[model samples]
Target: METHKSLSPDPNPAAEDDDHPAARRIHRLALHLNPPQGLHSHGDLRMLACAAKGKQLDVSTQELTEYMRGKHRDVQERVYEYFNSRPDLQTPIEISKDEHRELCMRQLLGLVREAGIRPFRYVAEDPFKYFAIAEAVGSVDMSLGIKMGVQYSLWGGSVINLGTKKHRDKYFEGIDNLEYPGCFAMTELHHGSNVQGLQTTATFDPLTDEFVIDTPNDGAIKWWIGNAAVHGKFATVFAKLLLPTHDIKGIADMGVHAFIVPIRDLKTHKTLPGIEINDCGHKVGLNGVDNGALRFRSVRIPRDNLLNRFGDVSRDGKYTSSLPSINKRFAATLGELVGGRVGLGYSSVGVLKIAVTIAIRYSLLRQQFGPPKQPEVSILDYQSHQHKLMPMLASTYAFHFATLHLVEKYSEMKKSHDEQLVGDVHALSAGLKAYVTSFTAKSLSICREACGGHGYAAVNRFGSLRNDHDIFQTFEGDNTVLLQQVAGDLLKQYQQKFQGGTFAVTWNYLRESMNAYLSQPNPVTSRWESEDHLRDPKFQLDAFRYRTSRLLQSAAMRLRKHSKTLGSFGAWNRCLNHLLTLAESHIESVILEKFIEAIKRYILVSALEGGSFAIHKLTEYLSFQVRNIARELVDAFDLPDHVTRAPIGMQSTVEAYSQYTQYAGF
Candidate 1:
């Protein structure tokens, strides 16, 4: 394979000191590249830090650009050299006729194992791990495919295991060990997100003690399933379970049930008698995964194959569920999707980190304008450049902090079986996933643009990163759809408060609504004298604490008022835009609040570092940089300064002092 040369190391020794201009620039760049260390525990922080180091954490963006242009071919050559030196890994086992399929799967899985990363790490690393892996393999198509497959299996397997112990036992180990590569096939061509409308059926065959699975028509065929085209041996297929005596052919008496259906003959490596498989041809991104369509024609599996945690079947063809209501049962199945959404949100945060790291490093090294009497100036020094980049940097910090909070909430909810908490997590994940991924996509594009012509090249990282992130807007769940789900939940909460509910709840709702209103520019501010209170940082932070409350109330009120004239869909659609607005505002408020809280915590560490102005400024800059670095930094670093402020600050000073003393005479 072809490789590019590496950039020569900077020869100027004075540039390494903290007080030097280059040192200051490097410090700023490092903040973006690595972020704060305390957001997460030290172990995770170390792992991410190690990964960043492996990627040559200090490489200048201009150097990266030059490397991309083959001006410094050795840089690219070194990248490939590092990748190739690693032990070859196995891909997930596949039974395709093509030998390369097996070879590729083995290689892919080997890479994951060699990285010593869990599948969930992909969520934390977002687009970077995938992009890097792709670059290693010399194919973006393969990278995208493998990413989707990894995500699909990891997220899907987690949900399956959590929701049903039986499904977990039957499939979890196989999935994790790469024994039975599978797909979570829920999307049908006719009904993508509308799960209730799926036409595929799993009829109880009491005589044979089997579930007769059938995709009766073209529309019912499962499409867009990762691994289904080649690698997948089985699928956790969702179908409307048909009741024998109800005379309702397409109706689901027990809601949607998952069945572990074997699509290919294990021994023969061929499609089963009644199953049809078709590969989804190349798409915009993520091509390494074999996304395929599957159609079942009277496919049959043993009755035990039904993943019936929420619902079950009797030998006499009777349908039953622990949850009597079909809606609730259906919800039990769909609810697991929240985990996937959460994982995706985390992935978006990772993507943002990589983008920011690239942009910040590029900003520091790339010189643009000449001084009136001299030479070029660093683009990073320009106010406009900082303006374009800083807010995004701030927002990334916001995204990271918010993501950590969400993950904590998710972990808590997972540990407990509280339906209410789960629902809240569901709404939060969906809203945040939509908001963060969309923002990350936009931010990455901005970073790319900020890097100018060089950003377009694959080697500089932006172009490929952008391509890798493109699916974030749609995958896991469509951003708009997720926003609507958040809106729906908000509306439900609002209605409870609208009925003269508890003072605490009502006050919360009122507070949140006011915050939402304030977030938007309004001309009629004089109507409320308390509006001035909104400007207070403390008050703003408090308002943020309850950001979702009022939007839900407003949406509920609007829906209720419009319900008389507009049908449910029409009323929802009419208020949908408003609901989405509320969701976005609510999510943003949470992010802003988290950012402030994180900053406060960091500031405390700074204060304890002693009252020196320079120390304080350094702390402030570092805190903001942590915010800029956001989630990934949180994953890798610990808040050591807060607990050991004196020692930590002393250590930092000693390190700087040592460096200065060493170079004093030079």
Candidate 2:
């Protein structure tokens, strides 16, 4: 657990000339920091620079980076160091796909070597540490983050989770050392979510004692595979295992299983015989990942290549699995891949933080309409502007805290093979992944719009943030499809056989609500009528719970009726939208709970520890004035202006403009 320390601002107040803008800015920012013990202002330290230099301030400093980075300051600083050390990984806009891929590959490996971000290392004890490091990569450039994720989290992850001792011995060291560049070839051209529909086949040949793998049709070709176009030499291929009926056999359907298949020569980087790889070409985003489509004609690999963690094939071609049900085995296998989805959730928020940072920084500097007598006001003064950006800012904080919890839970689940824990982690990751990514897409757009024309500029970096994260909605698993899985799992919890976990609690909440509604239904209280209740945590949770329960009940009944009339698929299709709503509501409820918990732990508890009467008083003040304290909540994101990399997003607009003039030779 090596960690880096953040550089503290120089404590000597009088070191710089009083006339110097930077010095003056620091002095003014220090003013708010030391404000009479009890009072805290959520002002951006950067905006203080604007105030010192006699510039109009458009945004409030209340949304401070110190608050956002709170406990993770060390990790966040390390992230900054990693990116700053590798200037090549910084983003403007990538022009060539090949160049993007090469640069990302270099940085991915370099981060591992220099920063000790062991992307390939198995960290069953402290996955949150690994996840935080991975998250920091995204803030620099999403391509680099994604390329690293593909290499370690997906490709190498398959070998680690599914493979036995032989597979680990042969591949783990190589994968960690970058000796083997690999891709996870799971999603086919025709089948993305529908794993059962995959057409690629790995048939046993008893005489050859090898599995002959083939992509039977164009649709079966592995598509959108990262690291496949240029870097990958091997792949963890997921295919239907077609076994001879006469050969000693098990598994009722004998469905999909993972196998390690070498696709290219390590030295020459050339495609092996019977292997055809085609570039997927430029995508809307993530051009750096080298996504490609692979068609296997008759690629043959040894029987020992089967990643035999959950299932195995005997030397005599006997297929044996500890898990009797094919469906259960398939589920356990896919659960191993949930790491990718969890990584994506964290990555999406990392990018969104950048987008919101840029927008907020710019809003603080730019001015528009104001009273005739006064200097034109900062756009942040307007309710409309604050309304547009503040909630998103709050949501970002919420998502980050929620993601931290997800990483912790994921680590806990990995230590054991508890089926319930696995299912819980998988379902929770799927739901959170959908919620965070969908929020990322929408929030980026809102932040972009908040910045007006400047946000559209490539230099501001919203273009990169939006373009890269836009694909995240459909990345590991389509958000809509993933939500359906969550909803389907939730619906199952209503059955008599259902046990309890995080998602199952949503069912319990719903059942209690239904019972209460039947016993004593009352008119709903609106925020207008019950403003005090709006501040109550129980009220918020109950409201969200009611929405989810109502949706789940409606969807379940509709689905049941449809199933009786039509087929199962038709029933599901008809209730798809309702199911999606139910899933989304459930996820939002979880996020809200996680965020409130964070506030209690990080904010309230920390304040109490300080033993300052003022701090305690401030906490009490915040409890009743959420609207006035919105900036404080946003500040909890702890994102600094430097990371935003936009001129308008700097600590001081005047200083930012001065630097621009110097750079442009104006």
Among these predicted structures, which one has the highest TM-score? 2
- Backbone clashes in candidate 1 total 28
lDDT of 1 by residue, 287-405 (tens): 45567899998898998888777777878877766686878877766665565666667657656765666566556556788679787876766646765665665566567667766
Candidate 2 has its poorest 10 consecutive residues by lDDT at 606-615
Cα-based lDDT for every prediction? 0.58, 0.73
Root-mean-square deviation (CA) per prediction: 16.4, 14.1
The deviation in Å at residue 445 for candidate 2 is: 1.3
lDDT of 2 by residue, 1-666 (tens): 111111122344344434565644544445334432213344344234323653221233443454445455677577777777667666545368888888888887777777766757743345666677677777777888888788888888888889888988999889888889899999999999998788899988888999989998889999999999989999999999877775456323478999999999988888999999999998888888899999998899999999989888887778888889789889989888898898888878888777776677677778898998888987876756766765566677778878877877788778875667778788889999999998889888888888888777677777778888898999789999999999989888754323442334334455455555324322222221222333456666666666666676678789989999888999999888888888998998888778777767645322111111112223332222233444444344555555667775666667866654454477
- Segments in model 1 whose C-alpha atoms lie over 4 Å from true places: 1-104, 111-159, 162-164, 246-252, 500-536, 542-557, 604-666
Q: What's the TM for model 2? A: 0.83
Best by lDDT: 2
